[model samples]
Target chain A: MIVSNMSKDELMKDIMAHDFKLYDLQLYLNTHPSDENALCMYQNLVNDTDELKDEYEEKYGPLTACSAAGDCEWKWIKNPWPWDKGGN
Target chain B: MWEYEKKLQYPINIKKPDPQMAKFIISQYGGPDGELAASLRYLSQKFSMPTEITKATLNDIGTEELAHLEMVGTLVSQLTKGVSPEEIKAAGLGDYYTDHGISVYPQSAAGNPFTAAYIQVKGDPRTDLYEDMAAEQKARSTYEYLIDLADDPDVIDVLKYLRQREVVHFQRFGEALRTVEEKLADKKFYMNNMINQPNKDCGCNKPKTKDCGCNKQ
Candidate 1:
């Protein structure tokens, strides 16, 4: 679980780092499909990314359209964009 | 079929506006061998790819090109953000300014607007992969030229990063081409239209055969 007091920028940086790792791994796995070690590492990253995304959405609102939920009003449009200071 | 990520793949924090630099950088945004062409080429080519690995490789790399396109756009925007009208005209951006008024438009350094004619979506996987490999090198060269023209460390750093990506993409495309060649029939190695030929019944595998597959109608 992420620290509750982390700034939006800090949290987003962490999430983006994880997402980059996932994308890199995905490209590698596409070529080396039979590599068992890479497959296991890929699985672990997937699980970690899911957790990070969930934590991010809970604190900073949904990163994607599908993740928007809960009793709060529509939050997808509420947050600042990634280029904006708070959004990053 | 694709989702947008709001942030740049790499950060761009240019502190000064230099319209001259923006002019050269715009080439990568919409030039003949630019990121937009790269993305469209791979994405359009993936549909007819013969193997699953090649198809997925094209898709992944194509998607990354889209992100790169955004990065280049951001660089252009930042570099031209606060230039005065006189500065813009002095920088030889007067023609671009007259059209778009400091907005980022997909055009080469020479002011040619991006066109689909710049890319090919050949159904032949090997041919298309070879084209992709060449496109990466072209882009890398363009980046090198831009880096040479740019004095700003911030801009140079990003340009170097992008150039390195082109090298990596070229390597991957080369691997994909090899993968494709390994899958082709031994005798049909250099035959044109190997993937699209309807009747592959020619017994070219037998060295003593008088009528090779090539002689067939």
Candidate 2:
């Protein structure tokens, strides 16, 4: 996870924040499909979230099973599982 | 159809292990109003939903409930991790340890096994949405009760997060319900909506009103 100047915890905080924002916006859009500003924000946030995930995967390995390249090692089967201490 | 994201929706790094607290916390994993029930309830109810909004809301919220389930499972696992048998007996988990050991089995804090009968899957759209809303509120209340019993700041913090999500989900379900009701009253339900479709061909789940001659067709 040492792909950038930010520590793993700090980077994870950013990623979680982004994911939460996207999820909240998605719920809002479900009820208010015609909202103009929310629509625009949703599109931009999707791209931003994707970029963050790519950065995370590149550094710490894949964030998902689909993203696993397995070039060197099987990253999907790696440690933490998002539950253990220091997990994600 | 869902992908496993290798990180939590929110981070949980509980340092202290409290088996006594874990015993009660397991309720959220398998109790009547547990995350497992909530996820299965919403996901099952989405299929017969009349509107796109309700379906998406149910589907997404159900998926989020799965994350909550994982969080609760983690809480239970970490809280009981490496505890001695003597500690388990003292914490009143002796029966559970004898049955399931350290594994995160889906059972109530009271030791009742998880059952599908805990949730309802009425195909009626409005009925299903209302059930989803009630489920969220009940989950929120359960979290509050857990908070009252928990002294660990680490455990309380994660419980607070889960409780807050329940409140948010209730609001969303309410909104979705309002949208669906408005559409139903407007008499412009989805063309794909099974009940009283535009062509009057699909009439499943329709009430026996004069307007709904589903049986006549």
Return the top candidate by lDDT. 2
Question: Per-candidate TM vs. native?
Answer: 0.83, 0.87
Model 2 alpha-carbon miss at residue B129, Å:
1.4
In candidate 1, chain A reaches a TM of: 0.83
Highest DockQ: which candidate? 2
Instruction: Itemize residue pairs with steric clashes in candidate 2.
Output: none
lDDT of prediction 1:
0.84
For B1-217, candidate 2 gives per-residue lDDT tens digits of 8988888888787788889899999999999999999999998888888888889999999999999999999999889888999999999999999998887989888999999999999999888888888888999999999999999888899899999999999999999989878877785544645544555755555456876555585
Can you tell me the DockQ of model 2? 0.80
**Which docking class does model 2 fall in?**
medium
Best by TM-score: 2
Model 2 alpha-carbon drift over 4 Å, by segment: A1-4, B187-217
